[model samples]
Target: ENKPITLLELPTSIASNTILTLLKLITYNVIFAK
Candidate 1:
């Protein structure tokens, strides 16, 4: 029942969040790097 929806939505949201986090880290590094 709920399994199908979890399978479809979980990975995508997780991936997007991960990508957003990485982008933030990269941007922070670039701004603060000496």
Candidate 2:
């Protein structure tokens, strides 16, 4: 799902990056939180 985002806006870019990070953390937790 790594589409090319037009991150010309700084806050938008930061928010998206933060969301991606959170998603990764959640996925990891789901797998390891057994």
Candidate 3:
């Protein structure tokens, strides 16, 4: 079902995207803080 597919695949994509976004944010903060 759609729910199962979303639960399995969505989280992986979302997690990676979230991690990348967080990394970018942190990098920006570090660069601007200096």
Candidate 4:
């Protein structure tokens, strides 16, 4: 039997936002390191 997928099974928008924030932080660190 096939089951339906649910939103809870996937990463939400907040998770993506957090990832973007982390990337930005890393980019800033790299720029400042130079």
Candidate 5:
């Protein structure tokens, strides 16, 4: 059914979004750390 397609697509998109969020947080921290 749709399960296989969802399994293949959701992880990569979710991972990328999570990574981008983490990177943004890190960048902001660095900028404000001074």
Candidate 6:
């Protein structure tokens, strides 16, 4: 049967890359702002 959990499973790679990019951006912003 189709379920909501299936939706969460579909984007693992994309989510990780997006999260990593966001983290890097935040870190760089903090460093430059200092």
Whole-model lDDT values for every prediction: 0.89, 0.89, 0.90, 0.83, 0.90, 0.87
Q: Summarize candidate 3's per-residue lDDT along 1-34 as a digit string, tens digits.
A: 3555566788898999999999999999999999
TM-score of each candidate structure, all chains considered together: 0.77, 0.73, 0.73, 0.64, 0.77, 0.69
Root-mean-square deviation per candidate: 4.0, 5.1, 4.0, 5.0, 4.1, 5.4
Question: Which residue pairs show collisions in model 6?
Answer: none
Over 1-34, each residue of candidate 1 has an lDDT whose tens digit, in order, gives 4555577798998999999999999999999996
Give the worst 10-residue stretch by lDDT in candidate 1.
1-10
Error of 1 at 20 (Å): 0.0
For 1-34, candidate 2 gives per-residue lDDT tens digits of: 9767575776798988999999999999999999
Q: Candidate 6 — number of clashing residue pairs? A: 0
Collision count for each candidate, in order:
0, 0, 0, 0, 0, 0
Displacement of the residue 9 alpha carbon in candidate 6, Å: 6.1
The runs of at least 3 residues in candidate 4 whose Cα sits more than 4 Å from the true structure, single-residue gaps closed, are 1-11
Residue-by-residue lDDT tens digits, candidate 5, 1-34: 4556577788998999999999999999999998
How well is each residue in 1-32 modelled by candidate 4, as lDDT tens digits? 75664687456756888999999999999999
Clashing pairs in 3: none
Candidate 5 runs further than 4 Å off: 1-5
Decoy 4 TM-score against native: 0.64
User: What is the descending TM-score order?
Assistant: 5, 1, 3, 2, 6, 4
